[model samples]
Target: MAILEVGGLTKHFDIRPGLLGRLLSGKRRQTIKAVDGVSFTLEEGTILGLAGESGCGKSTTCMMIAKLHEPTAGTIRFKGRDIAGLDRAGLRDYRLAVQLIFQDPYESLNPRFTVFDLVAEGPRALGIWSREETARRVLEALSLVGLKPEEYKDRFPHQMSGGERQRVGIACALILEPELVIADEPLSMLDVSIRAGILDLLRDLSARLNFSCIYVSHDLSILSNISERLLVMYLGMAMEIGPTDRVVRNPQHPYARALVEAVPVPDPRYKRPIPAIRGEIARPIDPPPGCRFAARCPQAMDACRRDPAPAMREVGPGHFAACHLLDMDAPDSGTAARAL
Candidate 1:
């Protein structure tokens, strides 16, 4: 079942130049479309990996889903209710159902607070139980994430390693027992040896805990391993979304292909024919109309220059993508849905 659904979700960030900041001060200003027309669903106990470049609106989209940043426009429906319009009290309730694990463990954790304090904070905020009960739950939470109370309870953020701090962050969020967990690049900051362990821990925890997850990362390879489905975002727009393995193995969208190609081959015994994606990624502020990736896309066509493509289409069963070159028919509903 779809535990969380986001539709027509768009967020705009006001990027004011110094002189322009003064001129547009106290006035409606030009905006950066951080997350424009992104729509997707997270099924119960499943992982939906959102892969994109840094500043490609992945984090912005994650923030909106976490309700940390409100959408400038669009609907966020969770458990079939439009919680997007919920009030403060309603939002307070929303927190018990949806929790976010941030990317930077060092920054997300408070250096002054002990591990026990950090883990117990959410249950405290939500009035889950008495001090004694919350303390018990906190220790249990730490154990679930592989950190024992005796080992980590009194330790502060600075005393812990990067991986251990991140585990502590995960413990804090999981203690809430939220129905949906938005893990925003949780393993990106850790060392290579520990990255897989953390990913495995998150996957195991979600299955046992049964909280659907939205894992946001710039690494497509990580998404492929952990997710059942994946959404590819470029310049604040979804380029493709489909079953995880199909999209990663045989990508239809140029941007999706670029991402897969950009993944480094591990074995020295194997020589990869794929080349590194050339040119710099473009900014999201006032992105071009047609295809946002056309500037760097090797297969750019006249149609791509003329107008933007449509929503993801099924090239195979449950394997959909948004690209004009893959289409044989002219513009029609068959090609793409109207832009959200």
Candidate 2:
């Protein structure tokens, strides 16, 4: 069974009126559909990469999963229990079981806290562990993330490098022995040289500890390297989802194809024109009906602009894509032809 199942997960931020504006228009309000109708299942002990451009709702989805943002619609099932309806004690358990690693370690970590305090915060809050047990767990977690407690425990956040701080963040997240970890661009702020080490640490720890992860990022190359499966999002909606290797090599949706083509090739000598995705990303506030990516999709049809949101369709074994072009009996375009 899947460890985490997110079905029709949606988060909409209300754009409320200011005092004068509210007085002018009594109860009127608009909404920013940050995440819309996203659904996926995450298996135990596996990493699912959520990849898209900025404002595509990757981070928003992660926040919703971590319960930092409440969902306007949909259900989040962790271990077959709906998290949305969790009571006080259940919510506390949920918080301890599902940890979030923020994008910037420098900003996320408290300047006042030492490494040991930072790592011990969760366990101490739960009040389930004695002082000795908390210390042992903190030490174990630090070691798991390649940070020695003796060397780093007493150091303040300011004393550590970006990489070390990120490791500290990882250690803190793992100290609770969470069943699922939601990492929101955890490697984006680090130096290029340090990213690989963090990625390796995450992958190795997941393997050894048997925990699932939702790795959110805009970097397709990094996701391809670290995630077993990839969930591609465009303007708050899932464009495609499948095995990372398959999605990278055989992207079915135009947006997914564009994302794959955008990955930077390291070789300076290899010169090829990268496929350009034309047009600006659609605004999230009160977005238009129909497919959110339709306006920018090269393969979009007349039906795509008029139809209600397209449903996910199986394009290959374990590979699914949301595109009007994938509908049965739909005419094959040059883009869809190439995708097949």
Candidate 3:
């Protein structure tokens, strides 16, 4: 069953000019489309990897679901209820049921708080359990993350290594027994050697604990290792989404194909092809009506530049992509490879 569902999830940030600039030029406020019309579902006990470039709004989409940002428009449904309409008590419950693991472990934790305090803070703040119970649960959470609670629970964030600190951050979310965990680039700052360990830990814990996960990363290689499904985004819009193997092995969108091809292979003997992307990333502010990726898409045509951005079309079983090349009726559809 799907534990979380999002539909037309859009977030727009408006930039208002300073009083002096407003007086000097009389310029209108501009809007930045951080996340535009994104939709996906997270099944119970499954991991969905959200992949995109840095400015493509993967983190922003997760933040909106975590309630850090009120979406400009869209519906976020968790467990079949609309979160936007939740009451204070309902929202509090939702918060507990959904926890977030931030990208930078060093910045996400409190320097002053020890491992025990950090992990127990959630339940303590909500008064979900007694002090004794919270401590017990904290130790359990630490152990679950592969940290020895007896020796490491008293250590400060500054005292721990990057990988250890990240484990603590995971423990912080796990302690809440949340049904959904949003890990936003959790391994981006860690040493390369330690990334696999953390990835394995998360995959193991998800199975043992039966929790759903939304793992955000710019790297499709990492996502292929841990995620059951993949959602590829570009310029704040979803380009393609499908099963992990399908998306990684047979990406159906030009942007998604570029992203997959960009992943470096380990073998030294293998020759990599030239990337298919070109031109600079289009500005999100006052974006044009056509496809956001048309500027860089190698398969872009006049229709892609002139018509409205294409809606996602099913190109295979459970696989969908938004690209004019997939439109069987378009004049130039046969000119480009239909695979994309």
List the global CA lDDT of all models. Answer: 0.85, 0.88, 0.90
Model 1 TM-score on a 0 to 1 scale: 0.92
Query: What's the candidate order when arranged by decreasing lDDT?
Result: 3, 2, 1
Q: What digit string (tens of lDDT, one per residue) describes model 3 on residues 31-52?
A: 7898899999888889999999
Q: In model 1, where do residues sit more than 4 Å from their true spots? A: 19-29, 329-340
TM-score per candidate: 0.92, 0.92, 0.94
Give the higher-lDDT candidate: 1 or 2: 2
lDDT of 2 at 234: 88
lDDT of 2 by residue, 1-340 (tens): 7999999999888898678867865757877898999999998889999999999999889888888888899999999999988999999989989999989999999999999999999888789799999989899888888888899999999999999999999998988888999999999999999899999889888888888999988999999988999999988899899899999999988899998888899998988576767877765877778888878877777778775888787777678898877774455432333334
Q: Which candidate number would show the highest lDDT if scored against the true structure?
A: 3
Q: Which has the higher lDDT value, candidate number 2 or candidate number 3?
A: 3
Question: For model 2, what is the C-alpha lDDT against the true structure?
Answer: 0.88
C-alpha lDDT of candidate 1 relative to the true structure: 0.85
The digit string of per-residue lDDT tens for model 1 on 1-340 reads 7888889799998866567655755544557889888888878789999998987899889888887888998889988889877899888879888889998999998889999999998888778799999999999999999998899999999998999999999999999888889999998889989999899999899889988999998998899989999999988888888889988988878889889988877887987766535688766766667777778888777777666555566676666677787674435455334221
- Model 3 worst lDDT window (10 residues): 331-340
Instruction: Give candidate 3 misplaced runs (Cα > 4 Å).
Output: 17-26, 329-340
Highest TM-score, which number? Answer: 3
